[model samples]
Target chain A: MRSDKQSRTPMGLKIAAGLGLAFLHLPLLLIFLYAFTTEDKSYQFPPPGLTLKWFAVTWNRPDVWEALGLSVRVASISTVVALVLGTLCAAAVSQTRFFGRETISLLVILPIALPGIITGISLRSAFNLAEIPFSFWTIVLGHATFCVVVVYNNAVARFRRVSGSLIEASMDLGADGFQTFRHVILPNIGTALLAGGMLAFALSFDEVIVTTFTAGQQATLPIWMLEELVRPRQRPVTNVVAMVVVLVTFLPILAAYYLTRDGDQISGQGK
Target chain B: MPHAVTFQKVSRHFGSVRAVDAVDLEVEAGEFFAMLGPSGSGKTTCLRLIAGFEQPTSGHIEIFGETAEGVPPYRRNVNTVFQDYALFPHLNVADNVAYGQMIRGVGKAERLRDAEAALEMVKLPGYGARKPGELSGGQRQRVALARALVNKPKVLLLDEPLGALDLKLREQMQEELKTLQKALGITFVFVTHDQGEALSMADRIAVFNHGKIMQTGTPEEIYRRPKTRFVADFVGSSNVLSPAFTRRLGGPAEWASLRPEDIRIGAEGGHEARVTGSSFLGNATRLTLDMAGEKLTVLLPAGSAVPAPGASVRFSWEPSALHLMGTET
Candidate 1:
């Protein structure tokens, strides 16, 4: 017989869980709703009308395309730089012991832990002091500072989880340093690096504070949307762009979650 | 022919802890050599040194006459079956076994065939498609053996390879390993903390204590004539008699060892003792006796009459059974 008493969740807990989820996601739902609303001047709850006009409008805007292209390029380059730097840092910190190893790891993760504005201000001053002109690379540099922290956090955790014997066994079986890394280390940590890169890309795509300090005249999508918010010009178009941004960032985060949820189930874990 | 491995005054110290201290060891070619010790007794450290995983702090080591101090593990002609099996979790049984050959630039088809043959040798044939995690503990251990054997290394180092199995499987593997070692004619250097395992499987056993070799000899020599108190106490629960007790027992005033099985109960004109405890052990009955403030153990045959606890009894051994040893610590 089915044990209904134990199997079913209490009603109060179910209601509380539903309320908690709604509280967290209702604003995102509103942004989606507003994107389809026909009235572009202001938000009207239970919208006065609804139409597919804003999607067409957003599709034709050259300024929107330019902002998107810039954001994609910046996020891509930032993620690449972060992957190389973060994986190396994680490998060194996790696989070896040296003076101030813990402090160095803490410093690598400090950028993400601090407020974005703090990182933004310090990066801007450092760039200015170095006499480097603000450009696309400058924005990439700013994003990579925090992007590296995300990748490092993921990669370091995975590196620690991999058993040291795996590498030793590879070497014992006649593999050299490079061969062992390729055949053993890479397969063990590959999914973790991929997940870290995905998260880093998502973080860089929606970043505004760091880009504001680093970009001289560049208007990334978020910066462009911020400007459009201040000066009302077809507000639904901005909501439409916001909808696209949500989808773009959300997909990667979702993919990363699925990739890492069962990561502990890696073969030969307890053995 | 040169010895398969040799250590000349080798010492490996981890800071203040001397893991393997100034030990000279030699393993002849085509022999199954076992290093037996308790935990922290340096048996594992010696195995790592032979594998080139750790360098000696201040000593010379040679493997088949090659200077082995600075050589990396990959450059050495040796393979290891780790205590935990250390099978590659991500690879299937076949790929894991084929790993060594794959590194030597052997063709895929040839390596896989050799891997299958290795599995057959370990009695795990046709298990190549299965991952290490899917195998039982005994099966994983066999896979590890197959992986090491596939390389055809001159020396095979086993770090307590059967330590994880249950009693029945352990005994089975012990025989299988001895047979395999004999068939291959490769020098096998096995490390283990279990004394019975060392006695049963090793052609020669080195008893280690406190980062030093207490005694090194054949299993029979170690069992019948231990060189020191540590070797006597560690290797079979042999009764270690103090110098005073040995003198009273009509022997010289020196430390000596008496095997439990050597004591015959109900012998005329022998030491008088009272049984403190007695327990039946399948093939034998073990009785703990106290004689004149000295504790002694006697192993009675299974079908023999066993005395009840607190019973007074006379136990004795032949004079040759009392093996005396030096005063070295």
Candidate 2:
């Protein structure tokens, strides 16, 4: 049926789809092209020459490495924390019923639903009011607030799909609660968690607004790139870093899509 | 020996809805006991109670003479083949069958071998490495059986295990399951709404209605002599004669049940009835009759002349065939 529809798709719709793709990717294409341009200070079409020199300059910058290390660490720690908290929250909210269960889930997801600036300001004020020092941990905490929503969304969907009978069968077969989780529940929800965690990682790695409010003295990779765009430093180096950022963020999203694309293929699903 | 499972006035209530109300039951060891009822009649709830999945709201339960209140399903000496054959979606057949042993800390190789033997017992010997999704419905049902049977529990609870299979496959599994139960001598508590299945497979049957057991007896007893109108109407299609109809038949003015097969057509001194409908049932011809303003059904043996819809006929049964029933409980 999908093939039948694809075969009959109007020519206008096909061209419109192509245009949509180009509109989304054209800026990234420009970033790629300018990363190799020889010009240093100004934007120009059809550069006089392209060189690998900017790539080398961007590679040798110690500030680049420091910011890159900080961003990776923050995203990594935030994703880990999100996976644990998000999966637990998803399990509780989907698998049981109690007073305020729906409200608790909504609050869990509210951080992502609100604008990033709102979450950033709230975190900053919360830290100030508590007299907690702003450092690497503060940025991680801010990123975790939203990262958990991503994992919770994915894990909750998968949790709801796992049949209640499967859990009962496990208990009937002599599995304790912990053993049932390890053998039955974990394998069923494993892919969803992985996909959710990868998405959380990508979102955290490129985050800017929350990090701007949470960071006191440290600069993440995105913050570094934002500052470089305003300054008069070698321009192609900024484009070079943009290329790295695109690759770092794009790969996990791609991997996440592949992991969950056939999510409905779990055994005994419809049976 | 103590009964395989005993329930003394067990009642499971959910928010004022009595799912199982004041039910007393005893399942003998090594006998195939069936709980037969329509959907929401509490047969499945009773099975869950014995499996320790649902604790009774009141009264006591025992498994092989041991008190069973507050014990979790994992601690019980019973396993259930769920209605949908709830095989783990992530595991292959061998691992699924081995899950019970694995939880007991049995070595991997030994459990796998035992799983294979259990699969063999279910007549699905080698098809263990494949995932359940790859197998057909009947095969998944067998895999579920193997998974539950590998543990060698004292009681095996089957919750409409063959309900998903086609008619031909259901009949085939029914034969295989009855033989397997007798061979293993494990107490089998089978729950199903199909009266034919319960009659053929169970050594004793408990008929349920409105969250209570209407009758508990051997197949012959339940079929030959039902105690209430609900049991008579449910166990098999019977003509529930009103008190007026009973008096017209020269019996006391009380509710009575007469089996359709027991009524013989074209009998001398039989009550006159008009044939309202007739249908061929392969081995027997079912004739619907309107006798004295009450509906009656009679089975004519194959090769007998079936009366037309407007034809008038007379049918009668021996006095012993008319089983008197008590008031509705």
Candidate 3:
């Protein structure tokens, strides 16, 4: 009788999840529909005409291409920097016990929790005080500050899930410190790191408020969208670019989900 | 034979609590030694200290005739199979087994050959491609052993390696482990909370209580002539009789331990008792008898009829069967 109830529970959950997925995708589906509609001035549903003109126009615009390239560069650089620093911090904090360790972890995670505007204001003020020019590097730095938190959280959770005894066993088996880390720890945490890096990349690729303060003359994709929204000229092209960004970011999030789904099972077995 | 591992007055304290308190022990070369203790008795801590995962508060540890003061676990020439087996989840069995050899920078072909041989030795020849998760608990344990043994360290430390298995699997692994140790001729420092495991496998068992070594001896000596009350109670079942001296049997003593099997029923004997209860076990009937106002348990063979609940019965044992502990010393 209990097994019969247990089997029915998952079927009910599957139906609920199907509805939930439809709700989430409905908005994105509407946005994609408008991008293909020939109407350029309004966002009314059931448009009179549909065409691929916006995609062609978006491709022809040099300004849109420039913004796209700049967003790619900033997100790539920020993700790389965040990945290195976050992994190092996670490794240092996960295994060792020392004074004020909780405080250190909180400080690392604070940027993501606090309001983005506050982070933007602080970075803007700091850069102004230092008399540093805002450019690609400043946007990268601003994005990295918050992106590090994402990577750090994922990596630290992975590290904690890994059994300490596994590390000890590796060391006892004649593997030196570096060898143990390279062969044992790295492989165990590989999926977490990859998931974290993807999430960080997606976050940096679409960041706007922080980039607004840090980006002086250069414009990333999010900043470009904000500008396009405020003053409309070739508005359908902006929708096309928005669709592209959504697809690019959506794919990685899907990948991240798949990567992390089996992470707990892998770490849980040894414990 | 020379000692392979020695702990001289070693202690480990976690803040105010002494986890391992001033322990001194010596494990001889190629000997299968066991540190037997319950949880919080510090047997695992002692193994960790020997493995260099922790430093002793005071005293010295020597492994293979060399002082182990500043040496790390990687440099210790010892391997450990952790309580959970600690098999690498990411790697297949072959890669996990090859790790130690790779760390030593052994040639690729030689490492592969050695890893295959180790896997075969553990009775899992064709399981090289399976991940640790794919294997059952016993198979993962064998992989852990194969991983550790491929390196061929001077000593192997096992911290309750069979603890996670069911009773049937644990018993099987115990025999396999004993056979493997003999075949390899490597010193083993095994830690377990189960007295049965220690008694069945170890050449010499060190009993620990409250972070101290209570007694160390052969299983027979531990079971038959336990030095302390703790040792007597911990190793095997014994009916602790607080005998009021009506003229000592051998010498004046306050207390003596009598094994349940040693006491005989239904014969004119040394002690007067009334049978309070009798439980029919498979091979033996356990009788609870009241002797001189103290309850005593005796194990009688199943063929014997059990006495009534309140019936008076006479109990006796051979003089040598009585284990006396001095009252004051």
Candidate 4:
């Protein structure tokens, strides 16, 4: 759906954008290139020869499986928690009025606004003060804090776009409170919630900074990748795993962007 | 028999602004009643009160002799056709029309059957599968009407439901609505700011202004015998013969409303006037006359000689045409 206006963008601006995109994605392209490299000991661009060995090595490693499993579990749990808390918070903030509403909304988004290391340190300190042990749950709780903000940002924008009259019309047409929410309000906001949940999952999946403070003696995939980078065990296998990481995070964010891009026009607007 | 709707001194206020102020109204069963007013005139507020969307600040409402206090709109035996139609975007026409029945736990086969029947009633047969977005403005309006009518409520409330349509479509819907009301025998409470719409469709109309009802009567009674200056000006085209101007014309009344049609153009009447201006309407000529510098409008029927500006002419009305406005007006 490229518009005529977009096609008519100045040649200099288009070339500049192409250069910027190349600058950002060249490193990612290198990662994909090296995933097939035969060199296991030393790193070089355009590696001496290409082989399928690293993909097999990553698939066979028990340690890689454990880390991958933990990362998936943590992201799943965090996104679920975020979806519930974020959607309810969004509905309350957008649909109702109370004292400190703006302050509460600002506070909801505060965790994502602060430096991730700062959020990590405060969370670590809080857990230490409470005498809570760092386990799988702790990592999930830390990720949930930031994940909730992503979900909330998406949900609030969508909730505000829904017309109030639709809800009232539902009620007037003989739907009770819960019925109206199910039939009218849910249909209007369902796509937004799904998009928000996908984004939250993507954010939680690749999270590394907060996981550093909250996870003790447990390695999520990103943590595993960081340790393997320092220790350098079968380095190309790390590159292979990084490709997996990229795909897992990329798909949902792509999907979420598409979902919300056309979300402003909810069902049954203008013909 | 109980009236279809009744408001016993109802009022609704928002902070210091009185949206509906001490309104007492009744609509007989099976009557086509229209609440007519300008924006912020509290007519919409009154309709909302009956629909149970807004509870009265004081007093009570009765639907078919049962008090509407503490009743939700769903629990009330009435349905509303919203101004915007408010069709469910996700649902097709059948599912949308079947929503109330679905809420009542009716079976799929039965509700779908009823939905099709309702659509047929609105002359939209075989439109069950189409989305509301695919329909024209008039088609969406019919779907809304079908959705509300499927539940078979004792009363139907419409808040300017035809306002979004063009003039030709609106007039057509007006006739269709009147015929449907006659066939169904269900009370219809319609709200509109358009005066012509009320006059054409309503069996009786309540004219509202500043949160109070100015007058309530049949279309003819309200038009021919408006009690207040507001009603005289708001209801239709009428030249208010003020006392000072009446004295200049040597008439008896202090304040009276003279209908444009009542003043004949060339009928050899007593008073003399200079034709200041006129516009040719297809079937009639609306002549603007300056009666000793006071402006008066005369609606001369077709085939009558339309006088030019500055053409001196004689005109007058029978005593019956002068509707006086006493202090109560």
Question: lDDT: which is higher, 2 or 3?
Answer: 2
Candidate 3 lDDT, tens digit per residue, B1-329?
55999899999999999999999999999999999988999999999998999999998999988999889999988899988888888877888899888888888788888889999999999898778878998988898899988888899999999989999999999999999999999999999989999999999999999999999998999989987767877887786655464234343455677788998876675667888998888999999997666777899887887888899988878888888765743
User: What is the C-alpha RMSD, rounded to one decimal, of candidate 4?
Assistant: 3.9
Query: Can you write out model 2's per-residue Cα lDDT over A1-271, one digit (the tens) per residue?
Result: 5965767877798899999999999988999999999888888898879999998999899999999999999999999999999999999999889899999999999999899999999899999999999999999999999999999999999899788899999999888899999998988888899999998998998899999999999999999999988887698988998888888677877877876765556633434
Model 2 chain B worst lDDT run, 10 consecutive residues: B320-329
lDDT tens digits by residue: candidate 1, A1-271: 2555669877898899999999999998999999999787788898898899999999999999999999999999999999999999999999989999999998998998899999989999999999999999999999999999988998898788667777889999999999998998888788888898998998898899999999999999999999998876689899989888888778878877876665556533434
Task: Give per-residue CA lDDT, model 4, range A1-271, as digits (tens).
Answer: 2864577777798899999999999999999888999887667866999999889999999999999999999999999999899989998999888999999999999999999999999999999999999999999999999999988998898778666667777887789999998988777788878887887887888889999999999999988988987875588888999998888678877876776666545353533
What lDDT score goes with residue A150 in model 1?
86
- Interface RMSD for all numbered candidates: 1.9, 1.9, 2.1, 2.0
> B105-222, model 1: which lDDT tens digit per residue?
9999999999999999999989999888889999999999999999999999999999899999999999999999999999999999999999999999999998999899999999
In angstroms, how far off is A19's CA in candidate 2?
Answer: 7.0
Name the runs in model 1 displaced over 4 angstroms: A1-62, A97-106, A126-133, A234-236, A250-271
DockQ of each: 0.58, 0.61, 0.54, 0.53
Clashing pairs in 4: none
lDDT score for residue B265 of model 4: 63
Regions of candidate 4 where Cα sits further than 4 Å from its true position = A1-26, A29-66, A92-142, A213-219, A234-237, A250-270, B247-253, B267-269
Candidate 3 accuracy as TM-score: 0.85
Best by the DockQ measure: 2
Which residue pairs clash within candidate 2? none
Candidate 3 chain A — worst ten consecutive residues by lDDT sum? A262-271
